[model samples]
Target: MEDFEILDFLELQQEQQGIDKTARFLQKQIQNGFKISIVIKKQHKFALAPLQQKKNDLFSKQHQPMDVTSQSSEQTENNDKQGSSTSSHSSVKMNKKLIIPPTQNETPEQNNNEQKSEKSDDDQISLYSKKNCSFEHLLKDNLLSQKIQTGLSFMKDGNQKMALEKMMDAYREGNEKLKQCQDQQQISVLIIICIQSLCYASQLLMDFGQFSESQKCLDKCLNQFEINDFDLKCKIYITKAQCNLLNNQYLQCLDNYNKALIQYEQINWRLEVAKLLVKISFVYALLNDFTDAKKICYEGLQILQSKLSHTDPRIYDTYYTLGCIYYLEKDYDFALEYLNQSKEGFIKLYGEQHLSIIRILNLQGVINHLQGNSIDAMELYEQIVCLYGDSQNIGLALVLNNLALVYLDRMKFKSAKLSFDKATAILKVYLNEQHPTFKRVEKNKKLFVAATLSYL
Candidate 1:
């Protein structure tokens, strides 16, 4: 009987040890699988740390209070079900499903709750996708947006140089995603600002006689203007007209000017209408139709004189146009009178060194030379040369070339040869070989040189 009792106690101890070992093994497996699931879900929400923390808090609150006895009972029930439903060979299949670990033996309600938790995590991640990304990527996008904004600000304030620099940097560095976002947000204003800056840059290039570059800028500006920006469209058309005029595409320029004028008329933009009239007059002059040029000039003058004050900028343009018209018709006395009035008006509005003032001075010198006032013409020419400093400059070259004619007419053969040589050298450097001005200068130089030799 004693031996039997001892054997029974030994059997009980061994069975208890086996149960404890099985429970521990199952608990470890469940904990490991729970940890892996948490990690995988955490990775999906990498950008939303606050949401992950909330999930962890919810999990702790639900699971932390369970006692070991209840955990053990749950484990035992799961183990029984698993052992009955799965064979040793089916363990691999069971592992593949990644079902809730046997130690937990979750109910249907608990499974549904887990699914809801996962769905919530996915929804949260999708909602804050932009905020959750890598800090480096986020910071880079922010910097690019800030740069674009700065560029737009500079453009708004009329600082075109700085605006262009910043805008170009943003355009180069910005990613496709950022561009898409900007488009979706209707941030076309930034693009418009960049286009406007390019237009201003083109204007500066035109001033320096860079016609090809200026045309390219105008093309880009026109491409960027949408149907909604009627004002910008009208302005771009006007600019294209001016560029066409500069490139000697007279008919095309007139067509563009007419189109712009029609748009301005529709918009009731009188200032723009007046400006277009001046451009039309220029085209007429280029066509050598002095009658039409004078007619346009008088029409513009009537509108400006009646509607605008003497201090207005349009007044000077009107006076200058009248002077050019009279000069073209060989009315030298009236030309000089109108040109002097234009010059005084421009000097009052803009300083003496302004381009308008310089151009008027050049025209005045030509009119004086035509009127046989050689002394006055020579003095004006000398003043222009001194102000411009370089005979090769466009404004100065025009004056120098005209002054050479004055000397030739006076029969000052040596002085004429010297002036012709200077003008030819400047023209050769500044004007294209095929340019009319260049050919004229060459012809005049040859005549002056031949005259000088004959006189000698």
Candidate 2:
């Protein structure tokens, strides 16, 4: 009985040792697997980190507290469904939809700070968008707008050099901002501003006698803007035509003016069309197509007569052009008639002593001189000389030459020589020696001196 009892004790002890060893092995396996699972979870979160952060940022901007409990419940339900879908898999994977949970026990101050931060972020984004978006936005920005205003003020003050510098700087900055623009409406508005700037710049350049530069500016605008608006296109075409006219590219000028007229007609801009017709008449006169010039001038005058008062500037321009055409045709009677009508318009609008009146007076004097009325022509010339007031400009030079011619006609040898010398000096100072006016004055002075010597 003792030996049997001892054997039973040994078997029980061996069985207890085997059970202990099995339990330890199972515990080690569980520890290693838990560590591997933790590493895998960390790698997964790392891969999803940027997307999760973006979602969190969006939530923060909403100004509402995160519903952590509801999100957790939903995530649990999703995991159950996913687990059922993959029931035959060896292990269950956690759902990867990262829902950031709100922290509990947060102070009111912290929440307020978060809301303020979000608002500040929104404000910054909006500001950035405006600065890069539209011409109106730039025009609204006080600093940027001030640049444009300052440029205009400079131009108004007759400081074109400074105005151009400021305007060009603003334009360049605007162009850079335009490159960043994403919206089409913003692009259209910005383009309009750019075209306006170019137009103004071109006119300014023309005023400074920078004809080539003016043409360059217009070309830049034509290349840059694909304008659809009729008014804007008309403005561009007119500017281009003016530049061509100044360059003496008469055919090109006519073509551009006709294009602008077409656009004007589309909008029923009759007044502008009339003005364009007068300009086209002038071109025809320059080309020595007097018949067409007279026809176009009459067309323009008829249009003006219907819509404008007799004193309208368009009427003045048409009448003046008609007078010139008739004068070129050597029809002094018709020339005087049209010229008197033009002078009446000028006198009505600008009074007798005005420059416009002085110009018409010069033309009338030429007509009188041609008609053998030296006394009347001399009187007109003297009036122009008095209006000059010591200014040695081109207008003054032209009038002095005409005055000299009238003196020569009257056989006032001493007075004619004096006037011719003075006129020649003015021309030589302002104009090229090879200019026709200077050559004509020289030839006339020679003829006058020779005739007087021969008479003596």
Candidate 3:
């Protein structure tokens, strides 16, 4: 028998008894020959045992059938030569075949299990890749894109509060996963859509009278992306203009609004031009330049009349500004007509409970008073007083004070005193005690007192 035959038999036995057990059995067989001793270093002991056992098993199994007397000496010499040749062959074969078992501690089944595990792992990775691609496709068509469109529609309809909430939810949902995705072009498009949605949401917040909240949202949107793009920079300035308007910083508001107007003009954005005209009119009104205010208001009206439908909110904004201008100029009849048109438009667009409607109601009362319809004026004032009873609002107080003045002019001193006192009490709470309006209210109180004394 040759060493190759012995090795083949030992491998068969190892398959039956497991690698570790077969190795120990063969190591004992090696110990019986010529008192061969092994001196294993502590670290090498585990590694050397299996190799030594395999060598011994090969020698014993191959030489067992040879002549034990005459051939023993000659066989020993030949065995040394065979060992060298066999080792050299094994070394060469090692490059092509991985036939050696891992160790005494490793089994044939373990190697099979390991190969199966590696194959399963690769299949799992492939499955995950397919799922990710499908998920991204679904998000692009069904989730993120649809959300962006819905949010934009809500913003356009002046349902800004709801639109902002939805836009922010969409932005957060897309941002984390979009960052990690491999589709660079798709991710870039999604990011641009999200930023645009957020910008619209911020604008809506400004429209809905949440100036600080709108500013914070704008800051977050700008922080998420580069603001250096011309279009995006224009939006940033427009948002800042809205904030300044709400903060009553009229000059800053005018400056930013003009900046936005210049950008819109250069880009030929007609709708944006109309919108900026409305904003500029607001600033002009605040500055008490009613001429400039009326000019801008008419510019917006012309744009809306030509481009937008009758029921559009931009038309209402234009009419509303015209009404405000006439009211400021004391043109009662024209003011009443424009304001009534504005009121109907707003009611159709946003319903009567909106704050914009409240302002219209107050303006209607002023127009009635200017038209000498005391009965109608009183009715409107009483309705507002009921609607916003004890509310701390400077505008409401001003309306109440104006209504009292109407009564005082008619020598209805008792009703005048009542309205005056109510307005004063509200103003005292809502305005600073040392405010200029407080002095005006004091003067009105003195007139009421004098009227009361004369009536008594």
Candidate 4:
């Protein structure tokens, strides 16, 4: 429910007094998650022509906020004469959505306001093309989309090399076409194409484990676009964040996630914001910032509770995260409680044998083992071991390790070694000896040997 930037609107009157008043109003309205944007598409249709002319005179495109010395004050006043009548001397009001179309009578002016409302905040900056044809025009004018599409098709088919090549073709095309962009629309189309192709290629490169190359693609895309391109910038930050997440660079992931979170917050896109907050909380939990992690995680669930059903998979995920955090904190009681809730939710949503249940069962088993509830922990571990059904995986390895620990605690050395050996073999294949999971199992082996000797 935090207020965030939803739109950057074009105010027809940017007079010093008017801007001061507008800024003050915006400061107040922003508290409710509103921002200033009043686009009279029909009236401003002609109002934007000089922007193009200004471009022709000097710069390649208008500056962000796209300032142009517009039509005289008198003409602009006459255009909004209808609005000026009852809007109380340009007094601003705020609401969750609608900006209150002046005079609700069905004039084309009202329809224009309807169009503005129909637009998401991102569309507000398309000053020249009021028709919202940018996306359509994007499809039509984008020269390299075929290549980009082919790249994705190759990616879908699991052909990473070919996918990378086609994306390169699109990238080169974008590089060439962007330089040739003479107008705002042309450049806008090229920017989207560039970001789309580059972000896709960046993700593709991530799969290849060429992270530096992947990052270079996004860096180039970021450099190509200016700050005013909020949507495009947001996409790049998200892609960069994904790269960081995959590479386990938690701090960088938090930075990028927070950047996108700010943009989502501005629009008061509560669901997305909540989802990001939960993700951030997970990362914080990974960093052992349990205090903030638990706080943010609960806030996320609260937001979701208002929007989604109680049994929603997303809420279930939040529950699982909280469970994990509490487990890490060694608060087994709360950990089990949340894990049980998620386990039930997942079972109802995806059925008992679904892989989602494996996570809950595994964590719950670990919690039980930590609590010295060997019998309960053994049962949960055995259940998931059966559910794994011959799959060799990290989760299965960890569970087997836990099951062995439980067996060791119960003094069943024979059963313990059998479980421990299986875990050892899996970890040898999947993890380096120095890796934490492997190290844990290896360290346990030493203890197992000592206990065996003592038993002998």
Per-model CA lDDT versus the true structure: 0.49, 0.54, 0.51, 0.57
The positional error of residue 389 in candidate 1, measured at the CA in angstroms, is 4.4
Off by over 4 Å in 2: 1-197, 204-210, 370-375, 388-397, 400-456
lDDT (10s digit) by residue, model 3, range 29-52: 122221111111111123345533
Q: How accurate is candidate 4 locally (lDDT)?
A: 0.57
Candidate 1: segments with Cα more than 4 A from true spot: 1-190, 204-213, 224-227, 288-291, 347-355, 389-392, 411-443
Regions more than 4 Å wrong, model 3:
1-253, 282-295, 305-307, 350-355, 389-391, 410-414
Name the better of 2 and 3 by lDDT: 2
Candidate 4: Cα lDDT at 257: 78
Find the candidate with the highest TM-score and give its number. Answer: 2
Cα distance off (Å), candidate 3, residue 203: 14
What TM-score against the true fold does each predicted structure earn? 0.54, 0.54, 0.45, 0.52
lDDT string for model 1 (365-385, tens) is 656654557678777776776
TM-score of candidate 4 on Cα atoms, chains taken together: 0.52
Tens-place lDDT digits, model 4, residues 1-456: 111110101110011001111111101122233222221111111233543343233212220111123211212111211111222121111221211112121122223122322333222112123325545566555568667777877765656678888888877886687666566555555555565677777866765445568889988766644433343455568678767765556567777876877765554455666677677776565555577677667767766676567877878988888887776566778888989998999999989888778778877765565455768978988898899888765456667766776676666778879988997787665445655446655666666666566555
Best-to-worst order by lDDT is: 4, 2, 3, 1
Per-residue lDDT value at 52 in model 3: 38
